[model samples]
Target chain A: MPTIDILLPGFGLDTDQGYPAFCGVFLVRGPDAAGQPRNILVDAAHVGRRPFLWTALADHGLSADDIDTVVLTHAHWDHVQNIDLFPGATLVVHPDERRYAHTPHANDWATPAWTGLLLEQLPVREVGDGEEIIPGVEVLGLPGHSPGSIGLVVHTEAGRATITGDALHFAYVATTGRNPLVFWDADQAARSIGRILDVSDVIYPGHDRPFRLTADGGIDYLAPFALTVTGAGPDTPGLRFADSSARPSWVMPGIQEQRALYEKNADDSARRISRVPRVVRPAAAPRAAGPGSG
Target chain B: MPTIDILLPGFGLDTDQGYPAFCGVFLVRGPDAAGQPRNILVDAAHVGRRPFLWTALADHGLSADDIDTVVLTHAHWDHVQNIDLFPGATLVVHPDERRYAHTPHANDWATPAWTGLLLEQLPVREVGDGEEIIPGVEVLGLPGHSPGSIGLVVHTEAGRATITGDALHFAYVATTGRNPLVFWDADQAARSIGRILDVSDVIYPGHDRPFRLTADGGIDYLAPFALTVTGAGPDTPGLRFADSSARPSWVMPGIQEQRALYEKNADDSARRISRVPRVVRPAAAPRAAGPGSG
Candidate 1:
């Protein structure tokens, strides 16, 4: 059987505090009974520590040609920057994501390579909810932040480890019972996070380092790390992980409950806001005015 | 001062449709001052019309190399399939759209080329809401279907024509004031349509043919084409363009009124719903019978 090596590509620092944000690259290699190696690279960095992905692959003495498949956790620039860099690698992503690529006025950050023009020329294969890309890796559809956002689960020798993607941006998101304000659908994200916790023992967030779920159901992190503001006040620092117990709440039921509460409230609030108004209020109306003016 | 010609590209329909969707394309010829004869292709086809664009260009005795600038009104798949086909052309788009391309799971109809991957590889330049790319063309930010959506206003001999992208998918969208349910934000789409109406006399929809906004504030067809829904329920024939007047009150004013109503009631309704109980009443639960329960 061919050996499988999971690679951590590089680390980037949050511009505000200079704390590091890890850029992760996963390399999956193993053989069927036929004994041929199947190689895959999942989610390359668009922001901090981006260069390390290329360097990490080089360090493994593998070129871009060595990667046969690339799976994107989501379409965020941070997660997909190195996509085009993979050259001819066949990209596997959700079908909803395919439509997202076409909507105009959508954001793509400032990176030049992350444009519609490049994706047009690149090779891509569309997958949908609950589908398996390979033997051990399964795609989970988690829409909210965007219609096609997804999480990936890998059944490993140790157990099942799931990459939560943007379903949970940081560990604290699950711990404090606070849903980060920056999301497309707060309710959908909450549901997705709940589903994620039910399925996996460990979670790797899109923005933060890997962490473990604690017995008390909390995300327990060992070391200090950079965090995202996420429309929450800046004081909430995203934590870094070192080992199995490093980030604990991910495995804890207590943390899961908190996340559930936050998700439910936040989502309801957003949906309420999106509906059309029954009465029109004048521009100068007071904030606490009763309904039915305009 | 380059000579420019606007050529419409071919359509991009699948075998399921049997024939290609004859979506329109426009070619812009650089003004007489430059004398170099620069050609621009706008809004490629969604189907069999691929060769149509090429043939139109060749009929004018020009090749792809003569093309210098390519701009899209928006990032729908039908409008942007063959973007890479224009190799050296400097692709101009709204900067906000660049970010939109990277947003996952939204606007699932776009081809990957219209998203981050294309932006990454192409020598693309970003334009702002009111920025001008060429002497006769100006950008107008129009958001609703997608966050970074934009329209292009071209000042020409034919009068000021605005390519509305998907802001007005059909003439009725503007006349009836009815925005589609598929929009990310229907209110935003309505506002954008209103803005586009204020700026130009001629309007071009993403689908269907072009039309002229009449002086009496009504939508009038510039050509003799009608909208037909092929796959709707059998009992009801889909709505047609010819059956309605230029002013569609239901879509336009009714929409505005609905928006007002929803906004007025949103907060109170939200608070009420939030206070509701999550559990259901159970018949089998130990109930107090007339004063005493066993």
Candidate 2:
């Protein structure tokens, strides 16, 4: 049976606010055709975070070279920057996405510099919609966010788990069916979201924590820190592990609220650091006035 | 000097209503590297209309093999079905469009059957946005009607002419800035239309006939049958060849009006045929009376 591990728990309190809100990277471990264990990486994070990604791999007793294959969900900067880290890995992307990467629209987040880098560095294998990348892993073309976004479906003992990169940005976006502000086609985005919801038992969102579909047609938010499933019962719909006392509802904060939360957290951290006393040697600096200071 | 000929004048009174309304194919005659005349076909028409297209080519003293290059604006079924007719031609398409042709969205007009045919048969050379396909021909990626739709800019003796395939469905849509009912992204379509207006003195629309942009930022409708510049002046802003007496306004009829016009035309054609004397069959013989009727 194949197993999945979260190298970084995507976009939550754990990630920096300035960077892309992504679910970092996921590593799938399974036996290859020769029955030897192989590791496949889902997406590489932002450019500056390569060291952190490497450390995470080291923590799992694996190195960059151990990554035999890397499947790109889309060609967005944050999701594809660290592709060069895995030198021996075979790169896979949707054919449409591969083309989009080369000539993205001006309004899109893609940059020519990044596109140039990708063309110069990576040898990519283009895959079609619903095609299997590996024996247990298949791709679903979900266009909207970009021209050629895709979702990965993995068959595991836990059932079908779909790694949706920006296709479903957060649980709130999926459950409430609110179109993301940044998208190529709103109608197509909505349709792709509906399609993803129909097939997957568990969904790993691009920017938020994972969630599972309950048997009774509701969602159960999985715990961010732990990989174990949490609050997964037919009776407990929309349950988040962080707050077990209250039933979960779609609670995506607005931009203002997010900024306020960041500011408040920064203030709190500053206050905690204020408790340490400073050295009293500052008083001597007042005697060194210049001639003009008279 | 290079010249252009309309192989099929897309959608008009001549085209079948049930089929695609498109400015079917264009032949641009220019000197090749060796200073010999060569023909570049802009797009290929629908599947079953090969004979009509062949006859049109023959009328112009050319054959399918005379087309040294076939430049696809997009991979829509109506625009790419007859590519096999010009086997010797080099196929040029936007990189984004080629990718899009491979993995089109379900809601889009792209069909898998057509896409499969294109992929299996065509050896495409992908060009980037603003990249030159030939010495005097440049590609502009216009993403709106489709994710990877493009326009061809040709520097001719008359002026800069843009072959816009579905980017500007009609001159009215372009001048009024009203998006066509069918489009991938309305905003992008509008922007692309504006961009096309800025660059080209004359535009060859995909569906409607060619129109020239006046210096005062108005459109002058070109005569479809004559292929001669009609009403080309800054004073005549909205000029339609259909009615030379009055300036043209947006004349896209509503569904009811269109249906009524079709019905009326069908009735008129039937009436004209009925005018031909029919063979007066002597009263059907008495032997035709059934025993029950008797």
Candidate 3:
């Protein structure tokens, strides 16, 4: 059985004025079938959280090399920018997600052009629905936020903990069928969320803390939200820590455009590979397909 | 002369938790020597700000193609991710910045592994210190946050508006003489900031709004901070907008390690190319050396 730790808790917050720099990072530790120690990192985390990841790992008295496998739920920038840091770890991504990343629309800012190529440079493995990452860890296909979104299910002593990347970004997703951001199919996204709820006893979201479903079907939060704002300037935010006492109504930017593009790309295959060079074909150099191959 | 508009006013705020998702996006609209209207976008905000950029551009009655050139202050992910959207515009960046981006440390999270490769796919024009990007805008070297960090100096009607990328991240750099983050050389970063102050009347920072130097050698902010937090979950921050009120003391992370790596790499040049694939050599496909080469 694997025990999980939230390396950095995700905050369900985004600024409409500019960027929303919040994403969750998890570390799962357990013994492999041979009884050897293993550390599996869930989500590489976007660049902003790099320092926090480092500190968290050090707090565990471990280094990046200590991480045996990195399971990326999705390739959104917020969730997968620090892949390079874990040089010794194998990256486990969905096969379809890898191909999907190679065909992101130019407007899909979340999937930058270099996404596919960067992943190609490193060691990787394709793990999809019903796949076991190690032992007692199962892969769940949670597509909707992006074409190839997936989640991981880890069997723990407490119960079944589902590490959802963006499939269930916030606990609110359980209450409201709508996710804050969606990149692929909303219908599929909804179904994925439902699937997550069906199997998950304690849910680990992409942008929020862990929450368990109550017997009456109510959601109970396991932690409080904390986002410490640094880089203070003269006219920037006056508050160092984002005040959690109050918040605004969420706005879904380009959700319609995102869905329309998904529809458009489904109709036209060529547009799918439009930006593959960065997200396109990647380098001419042959890349090792699986992270374990290295 | 180019008239500058803060298409999206940058908020000087970043959460210590995960990612700092704030970078300024500026639109410079004016006429070329031929007298035709030219729109220049300074700094392509990270994925988080893509919507803000789109909405701002749309508000300006323009689209991505409407801009003729994109002047990147630096190649950090936060400052330059949406370059693909402007398919037709030429990218203006410092030549050394491009090469420097080709070789960044693996731990340098600000400069992701894919920074160089993505820019290689775009139309680029290498501009350097004292070089004119247009008739009035000049490229200035500001290599601190990353080796290739550069700022742009534009001849605005109000006076010279220097677009300082991570060179001078926050306005407080003017008074405190220390940037919150420094990647390449702290000395060079400091010098670059001094140069920005020496040559500019108004300053446009990478993560903050535009400001002017006060008559008594102080900073005069032109705008208030506004970072609207959305996706309000049941347990997330109660505030919709990041409160710009009392802040905590900023802690500097990995400064010593950063400088140590700089010295170590300075001793062993091989370490310079550690993570250049994403920051590495990029693809086997020969990239056009300059954005103008496209």
Candidate 4:
């Protein structure tokens, strides 16, 4: 098997399984007999300490300008945010995506209200169901959570490896085979799962620790971390400094424990801490009696 | 002191602590010397389950159409979501607010994306600073969070009660005069707080419990379960919803506990729950990587 130097940049955890785990982006590089290397960011962490994505690449002597292309699996926020940061790279996306983002009222369960903002900013190219994004990378439309969402199949000697976006988020989903039905179309999500089971020896979910598939039709979604690319080729060696001074992405910390704490303590601190995002507020005004007074 | 009916509709613990809380609307009614009944909805709940500001009145056998006027505290999401729900109800907002919401880049923190959406749906009449919104109600430009955010001053026999909007979110803010400059323009927010303290004897904040200023200069915030609107005229009864369905506000249960649980356990739970609003599946492919990626 050839060596791919995969770099793992920073990511955020939605639900803390235990400690603060991370989502990762991988920079894949391997030397041919001629000693030339290929560079690709397998999956990028869309949220969290995002500047680190650029910094790490610059650290390794790579910058956005050096990248040839980006092969994306799905368009979830955590995986799609930094795409705009790389305005010069050719973006390879499933053809079905452009329509989804532009829908005045997105009907997809997985869509966010702000998703449109990202689409309006970048230059993207759409690929089809079976097209190869590049040599050794085949695009497979894995329509489950989304109609156009796809996964990338990287043909390697070790085995056919898959970047299975949210098609299979965690090992638990694969092991239990229990689909959460949170996808916009459950039938599509299920079909994608089936496609994933048939193609690769490994699965890289959008939000979870990656895992390998077992011979017995089970999945082992428990890998510690994967590597992603951030830097230019071997010519550069130092990382670039991104804007770290920006406001910290408001990560809701200890939401699960906060709920438990509130159950036990029910104090002011407990009340103040929660995992849910804040919505609207109402005035703390008293009720009116009739119209005359004021 | 005259008896006034006060209804404590449900609201947020976090976002409400800021300016949008000032966007509350309400119905102000006491009684004429002749005992004729009057009523109105001060600020309508923007949207969602808790149509409290409107439905609460309905539960009391009065419909929103019967309320005559829907007074807006400010034009923020939380205070403005349900403004359209009252079709025939007159929407009275400050003149500056109408202009601000219409301006391009009204303020640095202004959310212009949704401004056009709101304008298309509301029937609004603008009032100037210090202009009388009604016979007993007055609009005062408290501009701190935004250029046109206002506070509502209601004249009652109990002296003067000011609805500080985001002006003074907590009674403590008015008394100690300290602001928790988390997510807004600190300078403007501070100015709004100062102005609120200078006028009203009692400060009603958007978040914390509301309380009156004592002769000793102390402050008190009320607890949700402890608040009740007491005054009612002979012809007008205090607003009380005997039907729970009338209060369709969305309140996440065990959230404080959820936060505490996440903190205490800091375990696998954090990896499980998604706090961000889900994106619609099939967004446009991310734009090509920029020159920066190279």
Ten consecutive residues with minimal summed lDDT in candidate 3 chain B?
B274-283
| TM-score per candidate | 0.39, 0.38, 0.82, 0.47
Best candidate according to DockQ? 3
Report the lDDT tens digits of candidate 4 across residue range B28-144.
675544556556566554332233444456656776556656666665545554554455556677655554443223122223323323443445577767886555667767765
TM-score between model 4 and native: 0.47
Give the C-alpha miss distance for residue A11 in model 1, angstroms.
Answer: 49
lDDT of 3 at B272: 33
- Candidate 2: misplaced stretches above 4 Å? A1-294, B12-19, B181-183, B215-217, B225-294
Worst 10 residues of 4 chain A by lDDT: A12-21
Candidates' C-alpha lDDT:
0.53, 0.60, 0.73, 0.49
Off by over 4 Å in 3: A230-294, B231-294
Best by TM-score: 3
Task: Give the clash total for candidate 4.
Answer: 118
Q: TM-score of the candidate numbered 3? A: 0.82
- Give the per-residue Cα lDDT of candidate 2 at B25: 83
Per-residue lDDT tens digits for candidate 1, residues B1-294, read: 322243552211111101123446677665534444556666654322434455676887877566677777666545554454566677777655555454322113342322443333345677767887666777888876655577878787777787777776676677655555332456677888888888986777765457786777667866643222221112222211122223222222233343344456455434433332211111243555775554
Where is model 1 more than 4 Å wrong at Cα? Answer: A1-294, B1-6, B9-22, B32-37, B46-48, B111-114, B181-183, B215-218, B224-294
What tier of docking accuracy does candidate 4 attain?
incorrect
Arrange candidates by lDDT, highest first: which order? Answer: 3, 2, 1, 4
TM-score of chain B of each: 0.65, 0.70, 0.79, 0.62
Q: What is the interface RMSD of each candidate, in Å?
A: 28.2, 34.2, 7.1, 25.4
